[model samples]
Target: MKYKIVNINDTGVRSVLIIYTGGTFGMIQDASGSLAPFNFGKVVDRVPELRQLDIKLTVISFPKPIDSSNIGIQDWKDMSYIIEENYAQYDAFVILHGTDTMAYSASMLSYMLEGLNKPIIFTGAQMPIGSIRSDARENLIAALEIASAHNNGNPIISEVCVYFNYLLLRGSRSQKLRSSTFAAFESENYPVLAEAGIEIEFNYAALKPHDENAQLNVINNLDANVTILKIFPGITEHSVKSILSDPQIKGVVLESFGSGNTMNFDWFIDCLIKAIEGGKIILNVSQCIGGEVEQGRYETSKKLNEIGVLSGGDITTEAAVTKMMFLLGSVEDVNEVKKKLTYSLAGEMDMMEE
Candidate 1:
């Protein structure tokens, strides 16, 4: 699972470990014109420009490359193991992930890798590498360059980030917005951390400064007994009841309307009350891309605050769902879980007024 490509022209270059999980970025077409996963050991041959970046590169590929949609809890665990095992060997890490679930995986990774002191970038391509006008070369090359980036003898970026389509977004803050176009990801509520043009321009003030003395911790215990219920007009109490009917369900991310407002119906409120009384952790998140969940900003959401529904301020559903998994796995007390969800755990949300 290990292959090295030494840049010929550069001397004493920093190293980057590329973890290829599976995606269009590493695919090639055969005589039948169907896309197939390429042997990553031969990647340098497809993208010769890797030699010019002058970064010592090593790769570790999954035994079976899967579409981003197929990524699961086990895959997340395996990816963490790779990064943990090689934490000391490489300057930074770049994950070759599929575009479909890249944001979810990246957001989950942000929660898993707490107190990070080096960059863990996730990037992929809309077109296959073997295509005449493939974006894989640019994306992978930029990712490598950013991974090796350092300033004042310290790394420029020391957190989990998603570098895609010329922008570098905070991993948990980003969401995949498009599937057909190259502009597939966006961080609507947050500012861009970095951008690549003629040069890679970084917003230093936006970058989360890391504590070099802190320990690098990777979280593996995530409780997947969580569900997301997006509230729409006329969403039945029956549907909500059915979802919450399972006694084993630990947490739910209620994707409500703007500013966390929901249908202010008696049955709806009663349903929520029953769940909260049943010891279920219900987190309120705004369905809008650019706003925070203000629990008491209006009459509809005031009940959410009155009934112990936790407000997830401006946190995307990607982060909210995964955050629930992380918190539920670590803490057993429901009140403590509610407290943790109200605050920023790894910059996933703004510290909302409780």
Candidate 2:
């Protein structure tokens, strides 16, 4: 795919490459008053304040923009490939993506790009850039600032993150919780990496430190065959069987009730046991927004642990699904895949105690 590159600034000490992959942040009112992708080559025209920051800005845009809802495995490969190809040339990266699936994309990218030591910040808006009351300007400006930030010649933020509204969140830990508000994303299980007030304040302890010796590794292999099975109050056995019995599904993110509790009915337990016996890796995550999955803390969840279901402690559904996909596709050993699911990879989950 051909990329459109535009140099917005060339004199600053740090250079940041902006990867535009269609989103509301890049939309503008067209001749028909409909939202359309704007000419990002003239990004400085839309946000003139970008020229004032002490950072060199360059944009590489997708030839044909895509809605975030349509983002898939190939798009992930394309994004990671671009970052890999330009790794040596840019100091940091800013990805302008749609808010709908930004967390999923960011979570997957955190896994795909291993041994990363530079910032890859994702940012988007709930409203179009052309709108008079749009929050795009502040979000873009702050994201650029964070991406270019460094301490003693070292990148302050070495991991993938999402910058929206005023909070800088760890990518794998973030979840989009709102649709009609400016505060659309939250990292309930993790702390904000930074906050933008009158000035940008870095959360020094929460950041992943930059490692200069680590080389970038971009893994393009991702299996989309994984599925999420959410347990509801009145869910039927037929529904549970339909998902667990599917042979093509290699892994499942079981979104269980409070603290990973589920129906203790014999049929439900039997279904899980059969799925595990058939080589399906099941990870139990919580339906609650802010708690860890305590697999055996309650009687309802004891059967899940006894039947070989893995606990996804405090991991968001987006991260759990994508992490399962990443591990299943890249790791050949089934046992190794199951083992990795129990622990934190890329800070997506909190470490469970033995």
Candidate with maximal TM-score = 2
Q: Can you write out model 1's per-residue Cα lDDT over 1-354, one digit (the tens) per residue?
A: 433333332433687889889999999998899999988878889988877777778888888888998988888888888999989988899999999888888888888887789999999999999998988998999998988999877889998899998999999899999888888899998899999999999999888886788678898898999998898997888898998778989899999999999998999889889988998889999989898998899999998899888888999999998889888887878778888888877777767434
Residue 116 of model 1, lDDT score: 83
RMSD of each: 2.2, 1.2
User: TM-scores of all models?
Assistant: 0.95, 0.98
lDDT of 2 by residue, 290-323 (tens): 9889988999998888889999999999999999
Residue 206 lDDT in candidate 2? 90
lDDT for 170 in candidate 2 is: 99
